[model samples]
Target: MTGALTVRVLSGLTELSLTPPLARAIWGEDDGPEDPVLLQVLQRVGGLVAGALDPQGQVWAYLVGLPTARADTQHSHRLGVHPDVRRQGLGEQLKRFQQTWCLERDVTRVTWTFDPLLLANAHLNIHRLGAVAVAYLPNYYGAMAGINAGVPSDRFEVVWPLGGAHTHAPWPMGPAVDPLRDDLPADLPGALALCVPRDYYRLLREDPALALEWRQRSAPLFSRLFQAGHTLVDVDLSRGQYLFRRTAC
Candidate 1:
């Protein structure tokens, strides 16, 4: 319509991420707060929100500054995808859009957190997307949701080299962001965290086949993040994902 998938800054009401139930479902994952999505809507939209939309209408995603932080240049933040639209390439487009946003604004770098145990994400962020992982927090969340059924609260802090691109397609994405600031900040812009329910660990401990799959799914990239030099900061207990940051040294 406009171009090869339009990119723009919007206020509210974009993509499945904005949908009330879907947002909550995604946040709850399998068992988060019944209204987790409400928090997603209020916080993400409360401030400036940006998104990317593809011609297929297959995806919707958003980015914004951390909620509690005063909102500044150095510690930029992001969250994305319409969840259902995931595994369809919309996530990649959203990431590219965020990259463009960071570059255009002269922001230093971007940061996010995820469950280190979630093998799927490990692949997406590390092996495929070119981000590196640092910090490993244990039980970051209190197993409040069903999704947290049997996994430890372990989470990884991942950072990407913004300002440039270093990805392949199909198996690899393109356009890695430029290397972030040459120097590190005394403190990062914001914090990253996640939690899974306690029961999920049962599946991992009992299902050798599934746990094998999880390991196979994530190992390659997890190792790569380590090679890339992202560093760990703080790790806690609970059960999902924690936070991480790119390191200067």
Candidate 2:
């Protein structure tokens, strides 16, 4: 499955049927199928359910979103790309396509929750896509399996503004600090940096105890910073750092 990919809306049962296997393959779990009834309802209610197909008509990636109470906003529910085609810019392309799909339907903002400890995802959402983390949710999913099995399902609620201007900030040149390893700076500037493990999944597999320790350690820090009017606005993937800025009230 190579060459130019085509993205289109997945409407009827036939197209939506692919969501379950795709999701299972992406997460490496049999965590039940995506509810077809719900998908039907969402499709009927102006929601966005689309997938990207390779040249041979194989669905390689998919994105699902639902309309929010506000007409101009949509809640991004899921995005998955086949492991084989990842890092080929297909995930980013699917996201860009989703943004365009939302804009065409008069939606300007998209919201989603993602694990804060996943540095790669953090980079993709914040630095690459310009989404801002607005809140920290502790144990958001209660309990789970697959990639998120052991640790607390803490998440960062991100907001992506489709029509707003996004400015790319310069990377921080200060000494990098790992919250899991080093003491946090006593005097934080207008901007502060926190680092997560480059391979959280490996940490989970090799040291489940340490993985849980990371969640226990970072949750309060992120919660406190968010309460103090700080927002995660960018990430430096090279250093596995998440940058938070004090937002003006």
* lDDT values, one for every candidate: 0.47, 0.85
Query: What's model 1's lDDT at 171?
Result: 16
lDDT of 2 by residue, 1-249 (tens): 768878888768777877888888888784555776688788898988888886676778898898989999999888888888888787788789889989998899999999989898888899889999999999998888776787888999999999877897665667766667776566666788888888887899899999998888888788988988889999888878888888987
- Show the lowest summed lDDT stretch of 10 residues, model 2: 28-37
lDDT of 1 by residue, 112-205 (tens): 6776655455555665567766655445564534444544445666666675666432311222211121222244232323222232345565
TM-score of 2: 0.93
User: In candidate 1, what residue range of length 10 has the lowest lDDT sum?
Assistant: 172-181
Number of the predicted model whose lDDT against the real structure is largest: 2
